[model samples]
Target: MCDDGLMTSPTHRAIALLSLFSVAQCWSGAALADRLGVSPRTIRRDVNRLRDMGFPIEAEQGPEGGYRLRTGGDHYLAVLDDAQSVSVAVALLQAAAGAPVTSTADSLRAIETLRHLLPSSVLSSVKSVHAASGTVDVGWNVPPDTRLIAELAAACNRKVRVRFRYCDSRGRVSSRDVEPLRILTTGNAWYCVSFDLNRQALRSFRLDRITELTVTTFRAERRDLPDPVRYLQQNLTETPRWPVWARVRYLAPLEMIVGEVPRLYGSCRSAEDGTTEVTAGAEDWDALAGHLALIAIKLGVTMQPISPPEFSDALVRIGRRITSFGAP
Candidate 1:
């Protein structure tokens, strides 16, 4: 009988011992026996079984001594449970579908690795699950250079400095050297948040607008900055100071209309009365009014323009256009 008074299979006991040693680093025979609900003698027998299968389990004597898995000439194959296998398979499929262009090769490699590792039955089930799943691809506003993104990502992970040419919205191109920090994805675009070494300030560079990316040998100096996601949210969502900016208050909740509009187009605030205030900027009143009308129509709610009179006039013009349509 095992320590818990139940018959334990040798396979189960060996796997348990392997897991325990992997996690705890070392475990005495008595501790292993207690954990597995077996005797010290059974633990020894299980260790021997693992050794026979080429596991490098080393044993030592004394109070501080126990069995430990040591580095050996042989490689260790992962022993995954059913759930783990399924999870890995599912992840591989998803990555194959939606991973960035830069990561496509790596994703494919991972998928192939999982395909070889998983059993035939599990692979078939994973395939079935993948075939049934669907995703909508709205496409990126600007496709980033895959190789540049991959290099920058690696540089960020390694705390390295990188130099790159950047083009601003106004078409002004400049060279910049920055300490790679974090990469952020928002509103169908990727931005690299980095500390600009030349400017000595924090900056966000759109991956799509980056060029001539070169990783430097110099390690980056850490900076005190807000969380990567939060910083990106604040910078990315700031309304542009266009000449014809307008604020509109909508009767519906913010959540009802958020998905219908792009975050770059406006900033929204919710009120206690379930109403939403949207502040958007555009080059002209007509453009702003058209967006407002679209939002009102999409949400099926009334919106009151609370800005420049030109916006209200634009709405009137839209109404006139609608009323005059198909008229003699």
Candidate 2:
């Protein structure tokens, strides 16, 4: 009833064009008008406004080149420094690296998009980190099927709306419609944070148990969702899956890996020897032991298969069980 024409309609259209460039492969004003149910004249007005706002929209003549996105159309990513680029790359690596199924894939795609957007010098700096990077793997548990994880993560990051089969604590399966917000890893599990359309609440679904997933059309209210990591600590799964508790000392001062790989339970205490000892609980002792073995850091882990034994014999048994091929 009211006239948006004099106020917001044109402004909204212009912002929408910029948003299109921020995401897709290509966009044309004529096609855009068809999508928005407006005239090509209004689309032209909006396009010019977007050009004023610094969107490098390419409008070609004759016939084929109706409209296209130029390479540097996004001005936001062009300003990052070399160090910032590497830092972002590290964050992307951290996000997807530990999530069992190529879980951090969305972040990786964003990382690539960012890398391509950066200046050459900044990109070189980002690449330099890979070359100078030291041994930093914490051997986090990730999903075995990376393809599915990647697809789910992409859906969540783009707020693409999704549906997936979820197994409840009792092992019963149900289909859930979710607006996946983030992919998070804690200790050994990968979690998907989303707003549940059915439950009308925010829920964390375990990614490993997610057998099937598909993108949906139900978009989420992107602004109000909770942070994924905060949601994990609050919802800590009710199943109480892990049964073994392990303690280990870090090779370097505990401060080194503390920020990167934190203890699942108590404090990772520092010893007089400059190393830090960490305590953790896991349901599968052998699997936990395998994680420690890959770190290969000396004295880094001692599995306690049975509670109350601080000695190495029980841990040695667990290691043997996991390795299986090792001597008795």
Candidate 3:
């Protein structure tokens, strides 16, 4: 919850997704702004923009009732800085040049926004990447929940409450009253770190199944302290990443593998032994295969212990699998 620090904008796809959740929700403008981490005026402006784009936003009569989306608008989403738009447009066109006709538009928009937001010197190597990929077209899956994600981001930044149904790891479903902290997209999945007032704890919720994200004023007015990236790296990971857990004793040095892997386990001089110990956490047992292969480099390695038999089994299995493959 550290001040929702200024992390640079990722892709337009990410932004579009974060902002689209509030489209058809019933909530006050003030409350909406809080959820989006912007001034109330910005919420009004967003509402106006949606309305201008032909969305059917119904305004309620009294203060209790709030504005909501009606339906069927042609507008996608746009958050560009001008310099970014031009460059993005070109890059997107190039990226989507051969995609199936369906995802081309959304992919194109993401590139366009990047170009619009960046300064001229921002991507000195843009031409190089573009040239290398010449006619190479990247097929991508644009999440079906982009609009809702976009709106949710806006709501989170604005400190407004958001309502959505959550599907957890065990596949249990429940309605959530969340004060969104930050959005994390680490493992081919998107996560929202938030204060689950009901649970009275910080939790990471996935974005894919966060159905119907509508703005809520009931609890959003209260301030929440959340640092999304740290929270995500700490939580919201897929199941438990046992393969990600590594304990390696290196005679050479820790700096060698520092860039090669996530430094989940800080390197330290062993308490009794004179070797350096290092560890990392990944997504699953399957991921450990790669890390274990690095053990062939003459470094003594083992999986760090977690309190679960399954986690231990996972690591051993990974080792056996790589060894079976004659990993060198």
Candidate 2 residue-wise lDDT, 1-328, digit = tens = 1134532477655544544454564666577777556777877777777566545566877555566656643353444455555656555556655554433544545555554456665655554432222112233455334344455655755567888899965578999988877665553455677788899998877777787688876667746766666666655632233466566666666666465343343345677977666565554655555555445444454322223364345457756676786656
lDDT of 1 by residue, 1-328 (tens): 2345332788656645654554566788888888889888988888888777656678988889999776423333346544555555445444544677634444545544444445564555444333332222322455434345456666777788999899986678999999877755442456788888888887888888888788889988767877665666666567363567788899998888777666666778898889998888776778889888888987689998888788899999988888899799
Which segments of model 3 are wrong by more than 4 Å? 1-145, 169-172, 184-189, 217-219, 224-246, 263-274, 282-290, 295-328
RMSD of each: 13.3, 17.2, 18.0
Better of 1 and 3 by TM-score: 1
**TM-score ranking from best candidate downward:** 1, 3, 2
Worst 10 residues of 3 by lDDT: 1-10
lDDT of 2: 0.57
Q: Estimate the TM-score for candidate 2.
A: 0.39
- What lDDT would each prediction earn against the true structure? 0.68, 0.57, 0.50
Q: How many angstroms is residue 195 displaced in model 3 relative to the true structure, after the best TM-score fit? A: 2.1
Residue 9 miss distance in model 3 (angstroms): 24
- Give the clash total for candidate 2: 9
Best by TM-score: 1
